[model samples]
Target: MSFIELVGLHKSYGRHTVLQGIDLQVQRHQVVTLIGASGSGKSTLLRCLNALEPIDAGEIRLDGDVVSGPGVDVNRLRRRVGMVFQSFNLFPHMTVLDNIALGPIRLLGAEPRTARDRARSLLERVNLAHRADYYPDQLSGGQQQRVAIVRTLAMDPDAVLLDEITSALDPELVAEVLNIVRELAADGMTMMLATHEMHFAREVSDLVVFLEQGQLLEQGPPEQVFGDPVEPRTREFLRQIVEAGRL
Candidate 1:
């Protein structure tokens, strides 16, 4: 079975449907990118994968275990399936090191020293170890976002869901953050990301899935999806991205 599976997924907010019978599969150690225009349900799909938002219909299975629906242990689920948001959701009161260590210490019951050590190691890998003592407010947006990704990594999740993690960064800062993602992909992390960075997506993703109006329009290898998409809608989206100089 795939490491992650979304089958006939459906979700809604009030009367507006955000996902429509979506189906997807992600293998272990693969990097999958979700691309499309704004409000295309990319973010919502990531949220549903991590169970931050419950599905109104269908199932999300992780390694053959159902992760969706009521009675599931979401707290435990999050430990295995971590997520990073665009806003860099670090604790304001915590230092960079503390922010990253908190999840492992609190959720995984690691010794505080052990958690902090792991956090520092991850920070060093991302070239942020020097900023360990700084608060999120004291760091640049890229640094803060890097801390957010490190925090997720500290938990040692089986898979990660990144929700447009560079959207809130300055243009100069975006590359610094994406570099970390590139490294993660190289290290064989199982990741699913929602991104508008078309070039980066094409370069790093094993598979690219496109969504439009809450529907998954097309999905395939990056070359097929980006080089010669079969869907007309996919072609138009790429055309717009190319015109914007984003692809």
Candidate 2:
């Protein structure tokens, strides 16, 4: 069975439909990257997966259990499926250690000391342990983003949804944030991220999906999607990205 499944997924905001009959499966331990221009529904899809935006129709399943729809325990579902946004979203007043440990302590009911230990381990993973005592304002954009990622990891989720997590960083800082994602991929973390970093997406993704105007136009392995896109629209999009030196 697929690890993460979206069947006939549909979503909209008022009159603007953001996703239309989207069907995709992410196998366990696989890395999937959603690539598209702005307004292509990439971010919305990630949001829907994490139930940040209620879907208009269809079902979402994780590990063969339907987690969407009414009467579902969204709290439990969220404990298994995590999300990190473009903005770090860390609490300004908290130190980096507190920011990461907060989830485990509050949400998971971990012992205060245990939560701190978990945060420290995660900080070490991202090479940010030295800054664990610093506040969000004391860190660079990249460091804060990494802290946010670790904050999500502190929950020990099964699948992590990343919505343009690197989009807000400076060019030089972008790599630091992406490198943590690279490490997660290497560690076999199941993830689906929306990104414009074509080169990184191609390198990290097990499956690459192309979205155009709220539709899944084409999807396949990185080589096929990037090197030989079959859909005309997909080709045009990639061409423009390449021409813009983004791919």
Best by the lDDT measure: 1
For 1-247, candidate 1 gives per-residue lDDT tens digits of 9999999999999999999999999999999999999999999999999888989999999999999998999998998999999998889999999998888888889999999999889999999989999998999999999999999999999989999999998899999999999999999999999999999999999999999999999999999999999999999999999999998
RMSD of 1: 0.7
What is each predicted model's overall lDDT from 0 to 1? 0.94, 0.93
Off by over 4 Å in 1: none
Lowest summed lDDT across 10 adjacent residues in model 2 is found at 47-56
Measured by TM-score, how close is model 2 to the native structure? 0.98
Q: After superposing candidate 2, which stretches have Cα over 4 Å from the reference?
A: none
What does the lDDT read for residue 87 in candidate 1?
93
* Backbone clashes, candidate 1: 0
